[model samples]
Target: MNVSQIKIENHNPYAVSFKTNLREYFMNAASVEGIPTVEYVSLEELKFLNSQSKDIRTGNITINPEDKEEVFKALNIVDRGEYFDNETIKDAIINPTAEGMRKLVGITDKFTFERVYAQFIGLKNNGEYDISNRVANVLERRFDEIQHRIFNTKITINEHGFKPKEDIEEIKQKNESLETTVQELQAQLAELKAMMVTASTPKKRKSKAELVVETENTTELDEVKE
Candidate 1:
């Protein structure tokens, strides 16, 4: 994939065009790689539009629409921009990157990681730091024990980097397990509610000792009168 090219039309100040060597980011698996896994909108684009236009829109993130409002509130403080909930603008600001190029394709060099890391740290210091630290944190895990449970000898951290397949499988398994557990809990809850409703209905009580004594006394009195 080639680096993305952005074109801003002089005619329409509000609308910006984005072109990438890779396919467009979509909601499904087909465009999963294209999708921005980080912020809602690109910080680099926000800064650019802020310079060019008056009333630059802020909080215009739509990449993660579900939590867009919350994200907007968090990011709106930067560059004194206006918050726009409009879908058109939101869609335009795809994959906001700290480095100004949110979607970088055809990566050739190892320096890309450092550049991304530096930009990420800068943005984080600016209070808009949210990236895939799970990948990074997972990379930090190591085996430092003298004797290992699985292996008799000392275990060391594997120098080999993480593979995409392992991460994908782990995510898939977790999701499936969570879904199954949710279904089971829902079924159990429904059954408990049904049992409660059945138990709550009024039931007839047996005659009390006081009522039986009163009836015997009345019968004795009637016999004596007879």
Candidate 2:
């Protein structure tokens, strides 16, 4: 929760890469011998990493609890050094007039809100979600809204996990219904084909007019007289 620095070491033997369109970092080259090596990354970078992966959370990469100036120096976190006067910040928090304290609070709130907002954006676009309603007091209401949206039964695993037995059963039922419909259609087609074949076959029925014509005509009369 430090406002200044985030120091971490990649314990993996090979380099750990965190790449995105906005930021890419290759951190923690393998340490030599029994000695330890650590790298200082910014809080912003840590946020990005945490949102995308569980490295920081799951103990793959550990962050130092201590705050240091190396965070600002190693990373381009603060573009304007003049605007980020450490002494002034300390004074506002330590020995503040009412206006100074209010200004500091406003700045801190704005920063926190924006960071949480970025997490939401990451969730929407890339399915990288991390919302802590308990830790972030200012963003609790918004986090609750997001949590509801994520935990709704209608949602998929794109943002969160939803693997209820009901969903599986519903899909199975739909498949069975579709199979039944297909079978019915095939039966109807077979019946129609059978009717067509029956209609096309020649019938052996004789008409009464044919018998009267037979009576009028002699059967092989010329040949029989000879």
TM-score (all chains, Cα) for each model: 0.24, 0.26
**Can you write out model 2's per-residue Cα lDDT over 104-222, one digit (the tens) per residue?**
32332233323334433433344333323322332344444455543222211121222234665798899999999999999999999999999999998767888767755655565
Q: Give all candidates' CA lDDT scores.
A: 0.37, 0.47
Instruction: List the lowest-lDDT window of 10 residues for candidate 1.
Output: 138-147
Stretches of model 2 off by over 4 angstroms after superposition: 1-4, 20-22, 67-226
Please report the TM-score between candidate 2 and the true structure: 0.26
Q: Whole-model lDDT for model 1 versus the true structure?
A: 0.37
Superposed on all Cα atoms, model 2 deviates from the true structure by an RMSD in Å of 18.4
